[model samples]
Target: MTDRHELILTCPKGLEGLLLEEARQLGLEDAREQTAAIRGFGALEVAYRLCLWSRLANRVLLVISRFPTTTAETLYEGVRSVDWAEHLEPGGSLAVEFSGRGSGIDNTHFGALKVKDGIVDRLRTASGERPTVDKLNPDLRVHLRLDKGEAVLSLDLSGHSLHQRGYRLQQGAAPLKENLAAAVLIRAGWPRIAAEGGALTDPMCGVGTFLIEGAMIAADIAPNLKRERWGFSAWLGHVPALWHRLHDEAEARAAAGLARPPLWIRGYEADPRLIQPGRNNIERAGLGSWIRIYQGDVATFEPRPDQNQKGLVICNPPYGERLGDEASLLYLYQNLGERLRQACLGWEAGIFTAAPDLGKRMGIRSHKQYAFWNGALPCKLLLIKVELDQFVTDNRTAPPQPNAAPAPVEVARLSEGGQMFANRLQKNLRLLGKWARREGIECYRLYDADMPEYAVAVDLYRDWVHVQEYAPPRSIDPDKAQARLLDALAAIPQALGVPRKKVVVKRRERQSGTRQYERQAAQGQFLEVIEGGVKLLVNLTDYLDTGLFLDHRPLRLRIQREAAGKRFLNLFCYTATATVHAAKGGARSTTSVDLSRTYLDWARRNLSLNGFSDRQRLEQADVMEWLAADRGEYDLIFIDPPTFSNSKRMEGVFDVQRDHAALLDLAMARLAAGGTLYFSNNFRKFELDLSIAERYAVEEISAATLDEDFRRNPKIHRAWRLQAR
Candidate 1:
């Protein structure tokens, strides 16, 4: 064997540069960057050190031989020329990995077969015995790289991909690979932060990847120190004593580093289940005492005041790809900005996300942005300074426009239009407040675009308020509209005597497809309110619509009055509000169907909150499919679908205006004879198909469905009563 051999260190696609730097630091000479890999020449000790110490590298390959080849026979002969007995013992188990293709080796599987055959034939000829293959846990792992007519066979010194640190036994929905997580921490400057005694916090840490990796870096522990076995362990060329010495040095360094006051590395997760796995990973990594994982949400997480205040806050918040709706993510990003500003001021934050648009919504401008790949999806790591100035918005307020005549009565200090908007809101609250109390309503809409200029809807849930702004027309000047919105938002708190923070504002616009079903925020703030004697959970900040639909109060009441001793069914049951009402009204049994797991979970919580769990089944399935398959009959059924939905789980896009006829027919099939089916939709332009009215007895009861709160917007939703003739 040569004293100094050529080595190749492979890493993730975008981390080649960092790996090159790491190689240079490991005393490898002439290190150069390649596409997704780094190449250099090093002694055997250097190679062994890299295998044990390099955190960013995926695999360390020591070049055995490279030769030109034009056919599979030549490839086989070239591999045969190498002394296989020097690498693999006779009768040992081995695995071969091949990539690329030469002239005759058109596929990787065949190429690997040729290479394996060459090794086996050579070993059999020399020692009268050949090594068996073991892909799962091999004693020898060989890699062959073919390019054009050239072949390079190298021994894989790292047995498995170094990313499999064996620390994480479980992961969350989307987990960052261990090596990738280490690369992120190195790039995020976690090492430097730790050296300075700065704390590390991950508010949205999933399975504690960042926290575990950060602890390893701070404690100067070898990433693979705890690994049981390596590729070199079973190889003939492995020097056991030298490797043992290096391992002992790493163990001693880790012990000394951890003996000091442990770095303040903490992680918070909203999911309690995730927190346990994170703690388990930390413990498995041998840093459980150094890093702490807790159960908490981003909105409620606060940096421990007793610890260091100048630490880094690193998180990879959801980018709305597999989880959450994009529109609702805006609220989440904005709330993250608020949390950083309020709780983590003067700290640096590194946010890794796939959506730059959502990152911009955080309101903090990045000081430096690094490009990365979270698997195939292109992502960015934004480094922002969480200072007070980043939270301040520069919306210059316009002065009040002078009216032709001054009012004789003393007025509050507000702009002219603001005063008028305030007055209009106050008047509506008085009007709706009276009706709400008399009817036992704890939540109701006070205003719905009453003043066209405001173009906002305000609803009250106990003392908390939810305001939704309607996106204005393109013809309106954006600056003017923003000024008016600020004025209205300011006037809301003063007019209603509610704290500014208690009011959550979300922009209401015409949503397309499943965008309406997306999450708006993850505040997890739910308020309980009574409507017609039934208690329900209502979340005003996390979703586009609150859990309970205020406009549906009249319909729910109607269901209660007519649902005695009847089997009830609710299709597209959001939060199962109608089901809860029916169950309370003495319905024999109820089944609610919806497509969203989040909403179904909310529905279960609402049912459990009301002490009505049994006899009421919540089915999380596509309503359209459920209707077609359901053989059970119901005395009364409620069908309320979104205006349009293109959820990927469904068979096809659902357009209420176009699919109402077929939907009603499906619902009608399950309705018993003389049973009633209440069909409703919020599509303003929806027209019931004429063919449906001809087949069944249909009555348009839209007028009677409107309550006092939705009286002004009579078209808030249209309803009908259907029964078989």
Candidate 2:
């Protein structure tokens, strides 16, 4: 076989260009992008060098053979054509990673199995023995690509993705992959920054990916220097001597680089649990002495006094991974902008996020932006120069230059609709304010799209206001709807006498699947509020629906009133607000079930706040799955699932309108004789199946469930009391 072979390097999407640049830097010629993977030509030594040094490439694949293959038999024949015995010893282990689904292969799993079968059969024919497949760690790893009726087989030169630099054993909840982190640093010009003796900081560094990767770049350390194994080490054509020579040269370079004065690197994490893991990663990378991980908040981030003023402040700030996180993360991004402005005057900052719109809230002008990918989510790296001119001016700043044209007045502050919205808000506050105080309700809906133009729901949790903008119809001009939304948001602070910062704005719409429960922020700031004589925790910014659903207050009150020495069950128990009411209502025992750990924690905090630890249970489970398995009977049950949910945590999509009947049947199956099921949903057009009504005694309790605060929008939710006939 020729020592030179066709080569392909796969990388994360959106980083193909970066990988191409990296491949060129590693002396690979004729490098060009091929979908998400890069194609290149290089000799065996060059390929071995890439496996040891290329930071951005995920896998280094050496193309072995290619042939036209459409049917499964052709794919198997193509694989059989390759001399498998030459690559893997009989009775040894092998693995196949198949991508693409052309050539009649409809499933990747099935394609991989066919390739595996070819390898086993060929090896069995050659030596009367077959290599067992090892999915975890195979002696020989083969990659098969099926494209346009063509099958190309290659040996993975890297046993694992090169991004696995063998340094990080622990990571944050959403740490950037090591190679991705390196790419971000490269885009931010971290190597140049460090070479010039500038300091580096990641205010929201998770598990020290950026810091460790930056250290490696600055020290010129080969990314995989610490990695002990490579696919080539076990290959039949392995050139051990050539690899040893390259490894020795890399080791010498790293040792000499480490001897120099270390670059200044710092990482800050708010979660203390991540701090130690970050420190562990740094130590594992042999960068403990160079990079420092600290437990600190981003708002308090300041460059070390001994560090240089100019460097890179890069972080993959918790991008709103869930629907509701965007609102809470707005403040975080704003805080980051503020910190960059006040603390690091000359530093360059890069914020990587999936929701680039949140970058606008950061209050800084991006000098440049680069596209990247975090797994499948399209994202951007926003680069900003941390200087006074880039910072947002204070509201009280001096007027513009005398010769400058007058700026357009903001529509929210002076629009006619703004006044009407404000007036309606004031009227509702007066009407509901007194009622809330008299009833000890610290949180209540003050407005529910009361005005046509102002299509938003405003709620008050004591002093703070939660603003939820209902998505306007396509018939309405998006710009006009946005203007009206801004006007309404502006009106809330003035109308409610709350500070602008105290107002949290989130766009609320009928969510598909599990988007409603996805995390949008990790501020972890919960405010306590009194409701139905119990204190509950509500996180306005971190979630679309604050931990407590204001519309459910009446239903919770009824649960409490009806619970006295009776077992109570709260299903779809978001934040367990209903369970709290039941526990406080003197229930004999209470059980709460939901799938979100974040909400479950909030629920625990709410229960703890009320000092109700007696016999309440909190479980993280899919309500539908839990209901089917539940054999215990409860005297009372509350089922208020989301209108629709498609969370991957659940087995299938849940449409309250479509699945309510089955859901109610499952809940009723676990109900004691004469027990009542208070089934409700926010599906505005929900119609109770007449068949269900005929089989059981059912009463529409929606009207009775609406309190003084929610009467304005009784369609917000529907409720019914069902009993076994």
**TM agreement with the true structure for every prediction:** 0.69, 0.68
Candidate 2 Cα outliers beyond 4 Å, as residue runs: 70-78, 83-86, 103-127, 304-308, 321-323, 397-454, 469-725
Tell me, by TM-score, which candidate is best: 1
Q: Rate the local accuracy (lDDT) of all candidates.
A: 0.84, 0.83
Q: Write the per-residue lDDT of candidate 2 for residues 1-725, one digit (tens) a residue.
A: 79778899999998899889889888788988988889989898899889999989999999999999869998998898888767888878988999989778999999999999988888885437678888878899999998888888999999988998888899878778999999999999887888898889999987899999999999989999988888877788888999999999999999999999987788899989898888988999999889998888887888655544578899988865553343456557666776877788878988888867667556678989999989888899999998867765444221222134334321112246866888898888778888987787888898988777788888888878888888889899987775676556545655666545688888888677777677666777889888878888888776667778888888999999999889999998888989999999999999999988878888888888999887989889998888888888899999888888877788878887788788888888888898898988887788888788877889999899999988888788888999999
Residue-level error in angstroms, candidate 1, position 544: 11
Per-model clash counts, in order, read: 4, 5
**Where is the poorest 10-residue window by lDDT in model 1?**
401-410
Give the C-alpha lDDT of model 1.
0.84
Model 2 lDDT on a 0 to 1 scale: 0.83
Instruction: Give the runs in model 1 whose Cα sits over 4 Å from its true position.
Output: 126-128, 304-309, 319-332, 389-725
- Residue 420 of model 1 has an lDDT of 85
Give per-model CA RMSD.
Answer: 9.0, 9.9
Error of 2 at 267 (Å): 1.2
Clashes of 2: 5
